[model samples]
Target: MSKASETAPSNLADIDSSAWSELETAAVSQQSGFRYVNLCSVDAEAKPQARMVVLRGADRSSRVLEFHTDTRSPKWLELSANPHVTVLGFCAQTRLQFRLQGMVELHGSGSDLAKAAWVRLPTWSRMTYSGGPPGDERAFEAINESVPSRLADEAEGEAHFGLLIFRVRMLDWFQLRRQDNRRALFTYDETGALAACRWLNP
Candidate 1:
């Protein structure tokens, strides 16, 4: 099956449409190449931190992407301290790479965003937040001895649930082919209005 943005884009509008269309699909389809995106943030020491995060939602009109994370995770703390972040994803099938620069708004456990997302999460997915804090060191035996337990209730892991809303400001899109590779940059204003679009030599 042909994928979105799989063909050589004819114009800036085409690239813009294809990018958002694929993002919408990626947010819901596990099979999509963009399903998992690399979110890069800065730590307290000013070092760059990057990790894979699942794409949960996409809004083309608002130019926002949604993700879920455990509030106790290092990424959450990093983002809390500095909202500026870079999101990177590539689809091998389409040979397209998207580098997005944006600011993230974090909604903690009791926020409306977190509550709504929590309601939509499946039992197994919700259980992920119930585990020990992320990035914590554990003994090899302790890890090996861990086993899945029956889910307790709907609210079992709600305490650690967090919602990440990333408002995209710029997108650097590139496509690779045997010849005439192409690249474009799209800038969006604070209101998500298209501020500028330009083609660049790739």
Candidate 2:
């Protein structure tokens, strides 16, 4: 076998980092951001909706993932009615899929997190909030629905800028390999503490 093959991890027992830790690391990686996540939420009608979102932040200790969004988006309405949600991600490079279940707390307008996130946004990104609210019907030939490429005043975007914080309560992990597949489930207690980690046959 090649030297690299000889040193490769054969299974979870030899993993350099635990599942949660690896996920946290991936969430913050620029290379993984766009291809990283599919966030799921339940709407008022009790249907599940999934969408891709950039992974902006992650905290393993808190089991929390953070992302930015427009406050007026449909997701805000969906989350308002139900704070429960799931974040699904697959990293092809790692051959791993992660399904993270959690409750979300949204920060909008005056919330500290929202304010901080707003300050961090550049003017071009901030301009997205100044446009027509998300999901609004467009007249014939209506355009500029996306974030403006040019810089706009931060104040104009403040009203629509939102910070979404998802606190994970469980993690379901599945790893696909050439010779074998692996799966595991991790549950957390009420206090945001990991309670159990169990492996499953795949």
**Reference-based lDDT, each prediction:** 0.90, 0.76
The residue-by-residue lDDT of candidate 1 on 102-190, one tens digit each, is 99999999998799899899988988887679989877787677555655534657999999999999999998776677899999999
lDDT of 2 by residue, 118-186 (tens): 887767677767867887897755673444445454566788888999998988877776666767777
Q: What TM-score does structure 2 among the candidates reach?
A: 0.83
Cα error of candidate 1 at position 99, Å:
0.3
**Candidate 2: pairs in clash:** none
Model 1: residues >4 Å from true position, as ranges? 1-6, 144-154
RMSD of each: 2.2, 3.6
TM-score, one value per model: 0.93, 0.83
Alpha-carbon runs more than 4 Å astray in model 2: 1-17, 33-35, 144-153
> Residue 31 CA error for candidate 2 (Å)?
0.6
Against the hidden true structure, what lDDT does model 1 obtain?
0.90
